[model samples]
Target: MNVLRAAIEVARFLEEQEVRYFMIGGLALQHWGEPRLTRDVDVTVLVDPEDLESFVDRVLERFSPRIADTKPFALRHRVLLIATDQGVPVDISLGIPGYEEEAFARAVWVKFPAGEKLRLVSPEDLIIHKCVAGRPRDAEDVESILIRQRLRVDLDTIRQWLEAFRPIIDTHDPLAFFEQALTRARRSLETGGDL
Candidate 1:
């Protein structure tokens, strides 16, 4: 199966097991920003800490881990690196209780190109995510999302969430990154140029 189809299949499996998840990373960028070539499907699943072990076992039954001792690694890092039978990568982030909780609560169902509905992180939540990541590419993604979403995207909402995440995510200044990206996006839009 192709990447998109494989991603849809993954989503279907998650839904069948009644797991709460929201598409993120590139797949989500396709919906809110410029479409980019992404090799893997990224998703964040909100599983309680108590059930994490069983949850890890559940997914392992379907997808092959890209690395050895994936369960241990995932338990340590809260990220599961696994792949489908077709060799398509699937990154499942074991979400924690803060921003992730809010992100999942805001997840919205959107129909995929194949006519299957998949829940995805909202544009505002995704913007917060990109900002927190604070990579050059992630900044580009934030700008693209802003440009594409325009006024429809809520800047204040982004700011509010970033402020809430600031105390926890101290590596990069998410609010600063967002402001810079937002400024650049507005400038690019005003100049009639694509970011």
Candidate 2:
């Protein structure tokens, strides 16, 4: 099955099991503009230990983890990564102090196949999270989304979030980096080049 269909099925499964989740990662850009193909699905949720255990169990029941990793190298948070059989990945992050409420508050409803509804983090939120993560791939993903969905993005929101996290990203200068990457992406797109 195609990844979107698999994503919808995962959302349906979460709903049936009463597992709350928000659509995160690159796929979320589609809500604001044209769809982009991502290798896997990324869902973030406020999962308590008990809830996480249950949620992970439910996911594993349907999509077995083909690959699992718990690397020693840590970034902002320690994460358990699981690659499922359906070409959908599930990254379960333990709660951080402030991100839960912010994510829920910022999330907007997105309708997928057959009018199925799921909450997705705003583009601004997605970009901010990726920027904060500071992984090369995350940065690239942010740039690609920004370029492809520039019209749909709320620049003010991105600016605000960037300002709020200025202290953390000061060294990386994510805002400046974002703008530069955006320029490059737009040029590439115009030239029919890949991001």
Q: Among these predicted structures, which one has the highest lDDT?
A: 1
- Candidate 2 stretches with Cα past 4 Å from truth are 68-80, 83-87, 93-97, 134-156, 169-171, 179-195
Q: Residue by residue across 1-195, what tens digits does model 1's lDDT show?
A: 477887888888888888899999888899989999988999999988899999999999988999999999999999999998899999999999977887788889998767888889999999988898999999989999999987478778899989887888869899999999999989988899764
Report the Cα lDDT for residue 6, model 2.
60
For 3-122, candidate 2 gives per-residue lDDT tens digits of: 566667667776777766777765686664345677777777666654555555555667655454333321224454655556666665544447566767778888776676777887
In model 1, residue pairs whose N, Cα or C atoms come closer than 3 Å (at least 3 residues apart or on different chains), thus clashing, are none
Tell me the TM-score of each prediction against the true structure: 0.94, 0.67
- lDDT (Cα atoms) of all candidates against the true structure: 0.89, 0.65
